[model samples]
Target chain A: MRSTKPRRWGERLIEGAIKSTGIATIVFVLLIFVFLLKDSLPLFGHAKQTASLLGTRWLPTSEPEQFGLIPLLLGSLYVTLGAMVISVPLGVACAIFIAELAPQWLRELLKPLVELLAAVPSVVFGALGVLLLGPWFAKTLHLPVGQFAALGSLLLAFMAIPTIVSVSEDALHAVPRALRAGSLALGATHWQSITRVVLPTARSGLIAAGLLGLGRAIGETMTVLMVTGNAAVIPQGLKGFILPVRTMTATIAAEMGETAHNSTHYFALFFIGLLLFLITLVVNVVAEVVVHRMGREAK
Target chain B: MSALPSAVGRTLTQTGEDGSQSAGQSVAEEAFLPTCEEVPCAPNILRPEGEIKLEARSLNMYYGSFQALRNVSMAIPERRITALIGPSGCGKSSFLRCFNRMNDMIDGFRLEGDVLLEGNDIYRRDLDLAYLRKRVGMVFQAPNPFPMSIYDNIAYGPRLHGRPDRSELDQIVEQSLRQAALWDEVKDKLRQSALGLSGGQQQRLCIARVLAVQPEVLLMDEPASALDPTATFHIEELMLQLMEHYTIVIVTHNMYQASRVSQYTGFFLMGELVEFGHTEQIFETPRDKRTDDYIRGRFG
Candidate 1:
């Protein structure tokens, strides 16, 4: 009875420590939200400043400093959409190959390599984008400068691929072997079974994986700041992908260092930060809901 | 021991009009029964009933360095249920998978011998795999209904082979569901997800899915081992009814189930075909002492 008391106390101590860590994480996120809102609240105090903030351009340091949200918002959207366009098909195909087609030895070898890609620092990716890819695009596409949105999209897609491949491969691997065997037994070829049974069953997880990649791509700063030729303008349609554009992350990152500490420009940058945070929060929420639904259905 | 005047001979007298037996080709089969040497050869009581649908001639299977099946050879009678019974890991399921070459999916799997289906060697390199699987469908131990609607699940096989007209597909779906005895229960809810069905219904749906392809041979690997008693009974009854159209090869661990549904029974042990005979004789008067011990529940 005395020995049981000590063991129970030890277990209770460990449980309390775990529960406190969970609460501490929530508190830390709430603190960050409060801090962002506190700094951005000054932009809403005056009608003139609010009007200038929503104007057509983001000329923060010039006379009549206009802070149009359109160009920055559109720039981020273009980069994200282009990145998804490049990453989804390639990521999903690579995942399917890793999960279903690769032999055991090759699978073991490739899986760790894919994870190693994710572990690479973002700054290294930025350096590669600036040094190697920038010049290649300029020569190949005959553009005046290689630092365009397409280059940023290509680099971000490279960064997002590892996440997409690993998560979607896990999803495909989670599909039951019995389902594959059943499909094959019914006269369907191997490829037919993979497309018709395994892929469909893992559809929700794949979507969640894609959303996670989008979250990663949209929030990236250094890689895009270096390569996207940060020009604040509303880019045109398909032609705009090859033109210079400035994203939300790059905008705040470029201006925050030079802006006055208590200036309206500083407050506007905080507002952009808040917007970026909200977008990522919404994306992560949707991803969590999808992954949780997939887990339930799997049960 | 002598043959106790085969019961299959008596059933031939009252055979139904649905082409039960090829009129007395039995004289030739009985002649071959006496020359048994190494293995205890019984007169293959089901031989009078139907032609041999599948024959495994000295099949040996290996997985990497492990031998999973020995010199296993048997002839499965057409339009009848043949059950392979053994303890766990005895390779009954492996042997059942040989008919449709399902084991080809496994890595390091090697087979040295011929598995003949209707006199054609299925292991030949030139055979069309999709067509081979179409002729020989399978049902797994666990119910694995596709993650789609019940109607789509049944239509999957036919749609893969050829794009039938919509009306033709509907007819095929209805006919298959009815044949599996699940049409009435799922008729109103054909659009519902197959995963929403009960375990027994899902298994029946899988059976219907296989039946939609109109396969000539059906391989069931412990089809009812995961079901309740009522569900198992339903599956047994379904197998019996299905015997009129499709030949069945089942792998099971249940002695009673083998006796109840199978006309012919093959007992396997350590990847070897220990004994093969009529179900009743295997349970009552097995030729091999190991087979007798297994049936009597002395040890697995």
Candidate 2:
């Protein structure tokens, strides 16, 4: 009993430390949510001014300033949709190749290299977009300026690929080897088996991967800001892709420093931040649900 | 049982030259014809009336530098249950996977010699894998029904080969479930997820899924090993019933199961066939010392 006393004390100390750490994390998250809410609430008091802020234009510096988030929201939507279009198919296919088709040595070599892609800073991606892609798109596509939503999308898609590939590959790898053998033994060809059995089995994980990529792409500010030619205009249909656009994160990052503290513009920026947070929260929750369901189905 | 033998005979005959010649047969050399040769201590397990459905001649299997099966040879009689009994890791499972070329999925799985199904070498370059596997279905040690409804699970194989009429698929699903003795338990819930079934029912569902393809041979690797005693008894009875319609090759660790379900039994040890004979004779009067020792619980 005496010897067990010291062991019990040690265990209590460890348990207390872990419990405090968990509480600290939750407190920090709640604190941030409160701070965002407090900053964003002042806009509601100036109803007339805030109401106009929901209109089409977003000239924050102009006298009788407009703070309509439609253009910014549209800009974010366009870039994110475009990024998913480019990345989802490419990422899922690359994942399948790495997980199923690649030779043993090649798969080993590629996994670390692909993970290395995630370690490259977002700023570095911005630099590459500015130096290489911007000039090429401007000249080749005959645009007035190279920086546009399309350029932002291309860079953002590149940034999202590592997340999608790694996550989806892990999902594919989780499928039981027995399922593949059973499919093949049923007289299905390799391609048939992969499509019919393996892909469907990994569907939830694949969806979660795409959602995670979307969250990453939407939350990314530096890459889109540097490349998207920050012209705060509601872009026209189809032609808008090649034209300059400014995303919500870019607006917050570019203007938050310049805006007067606690002013309507400042409050609106926090509101945008809140919106961004909510979008990310929803996407993350969905991803978690999908991944959780996938774990359950695996049984 | 009476109707089963003729149905299985027709299907097994369908795997022969006349049965498959009409389908795409990527023409190859008319050479390398090999027959089942006599091996010492082989107890003439081939019943007089049963036909040879599959034959493995001088088969040597290797995974890189490691040899898994060495010069193993055997004949699988049509419409009968042949049990491969051995202790763990004795190559019984490896030999069973050879029938449908399921080992081809493994990297560095190299094989020398031939595995003939209905007198055609399965390893021939010109053979279509889809066609070959369709005729030879497999049930794993663990139940592996797809993450779909019970109806869809059975329909997966039939749908893969070609799109059948919806009504025809419905009939096939029902027939397969009945064959596996799972129709009554699952008929009302055919649309429900197959994952909801009990472990025993899931294994039977897997068997039904394989049967949906109308396979001529069924390769079972410890089909009842994962089940409880009652489930094991049910599966044993199911296998006996299935034997009338399919050439069943089962790998089991249960000596009693081998005796109960199989007419022919092959005793394996250290990747070699020590004896192949009728189940009763092998159990009652094993010719080889190793066979006798194993049956008498002397050693694995």
lDDT of each: 0.86, 0.86
Lowest summed lDDT across 10 adjacent residues in model 2 chain B is found at B24-33
For each candidate, what's the DockQ?
Answer: 0.78, 0.69
Task: Write down the TM-score of every candidate.
Answer: 0.92, 0.91
Candidate 1 lDDT at A129 equals 83
lDDT of 2 by residue, A1-299 (tens): 24544456788899899999999999998898889999998988888668866788888888888888899999999999999999999999999999988989999998898889888999999999999989987888789998999889988998899999999998999999888888888988878888999999999999999999999999999999999999889988988899899999999999999999999999989999988989998999999999999999998
On TM-score, the candidate that comes out on top is 1
Computed on C-alpha atoms, the DockQ of candidate 1 is 0.78
Best by DockQ: 1
Candidate 1 lDDT, tens digit per residue, A1-299?
A: 25544467788799899999999999998998998999988988856667876666999978767788889999999999999999988899999999999988999998889888888887888889889989988998798887899889988998899989988998998899999998888878889999999999999999999999999999999999999999999999898999989999999999999999878898999999999999999999999999998887776
The TM-score that candidate 1 achieves is 0.92
lDDT of 1 by residue, B23-76 (tens): 323322432222134333333322324588998876789999989988776778
Which lDDT value does model 1 have at A165? 96
Which pairs of residues have clashing backbones in candidate 1? none
